[model samples]
Target: MLVFAFQISRSGKSTYLQQVCLVVILAQIGCYVPARFATIRVVDRIFTRMGTMDNLESNSSTFMTEMRETAFIMQNVTNRSLIVMDELGRATSSSDGLAMAWSCCEYLLSLKAYTVFATHMDSLAELAT
Candidate 1:
């Protein structure tokens, strides 16, 4: 499943992504998830931050950090992985960011992985078509 969720900050977009991540992690660990009924198969998963890299040392600019993390995900993610990316390419100019974001989306699609991307960039919706 490839899903794109578009919403403003604090409008539950991040919350929703976090919830999905939590559920998937719990399922992978053989723990109980709070969902009423979920049949999630065990799968590897990854999440990309909206602005910062968590727990990683990086003196680079935010855009560079974001790209680095993205490259990591692209390199490691597999067809069975579930990827949840929040606000991809947000640290750069709109044109450059959108182009990179679009390219990433295309690459992920080609991998046939399940992906959930949350973004404020409406232009990215075109990828669905």
Candidate 2:
């Protein structure tokens, strides 16, 4: 369910969103069925903000890791769960990123599953407007 909305700056909005999601997940501890039984998806794009240099010796770029993680989430997400996504297109070109983000949003909404997608893409906000 879409809960409350606040009017802080963009940074604060993002932070609060993360915190709220965390709290909700925590609050669900005793209430939800076994996690494996629940079918919610959390889709955060890896490497959306920080670089993926932790495995430099293994030669895994942030972009590749991000793509892999996104693909994995999309593939594994169940229909009965919530999705929490971060910046969806931060690793690609602006236009490409926006397109991917838009399409993902459409897909999630199509599923009628609870989703919380966080993005720096202003165009997405336009969709809500």
Candidate 3:
């Protein structure tokens, strides 16, 4: 599920992603969810990536930190993983970010993991098709 909330739209994309991941987690643990209906898949791991954050101590910029986290996710994820990522390429040039995000989206899709990506970049939504 790729959500395109649009840049600076602030349509609660992050919140929606969080809720979905939470619901999946709750259902996975055999806990009663508040929803009327749910079909939770068997997930071995739940990975979430948020917006940019500078690794100042390590002398890394915000974009570099974001890339590092994304790299870690790509390397570690499996088909049984549930990946809820938000704004993977937010702190760089629009073209660069879009390109990187697009590639990341493709790679994630190829892995066949249950993924929910929330992005402000509208172009990334094309992956939904």
Candidate 4:
């Protein structure tokens, strides 16, 4: 099944993609896995993005928070999971980010899970061809 939640004003693709990942993860928890003896693993490589937490007090820096969030995404992903990732290294230099994004795309292509990657890296678009 597919689930999408997006708006015309903003880039809602990522949000909808995340929803698909969540659904896939949940579905895998029950009949899907037990029937096929399969597992769900998701891996993400998002660029700079805010954490779900909303804190007014002092805390980690932006860079620290980004790293932590990325780590969390990766740790939570499973093989049978659907990965919804944004630009991988967008917070860093362009070249660095492109390279990171390229590698991530390659990694996902290697995996058997469904992936929805959102990025502005047209260079990597060649992968689709």
Give me the candidate number with maximum lDDT.
1
Q: Which scores better on lDDT, 1 or 4?
A: 1
Instruction: Report how far residue 117 has shifted in candidate 3, in Å.
Output: 0.8
> Judged by TM-score relative to the true structure, which candidate is superior, 1 or 2?
1
Off by over 4 Å in 4: 1-9, 25-64, 67-78
Q: Quote the positional error of residue 52 for candidate 2 in Å.
A: 5.9
lDDT for 31 in candidate 3 is 90
Per-residue lDDT of model 1, residues 1-129, tens digit only: 679998887898888988988888888888998979989866766655554644346557777788888989988988888888888888889988889889988998998888889988899898889
Off by over 4 Å in 1: 53-57
Clashes of 2: 2
Q: Which ten residues in a row have the lowest lDDT in candidate 4?
A: 1-10
lDDT of 2 by residue, 2-28 (tens): 122324345665675566566556545
lDDT of 2: 0.57
Q: In terms of lDDT, which candidate is stronger, 1 or 2?
A: 1
Whichever of 3 and 4 has more lDDT, that candidate is 3
Alpha-carbon TM-score of each model against the true structure: 0.87, 0.65, 0.88, 0.55
Q: Give me the runs in candidate 3 sitting further than 4 Å from their true place.
A: 1-8
* CA lDDT scores, all candidates in order: 0.83, 0.57, 0.81, 0.54
Instruction: Kindly provide the TM-score of model 1 when superposed on the true structure, using C-alpha atoms.
Output: 0.87
**Best candidate per TM-score, number?**
3
lDDT of each residue in 1-129, candidate 3, tens digit only: 333445464778888888888888888888989889877888898888886678879999998888888889899999888888888777988999899989988887788888887777887767878
Q: Please provide, for model 4 over 86-126, each residue's C-alpha lDDT reduced to its tens digit, 9 standing for 90 to 100.
A: 55565668898788667656665665445566666667767
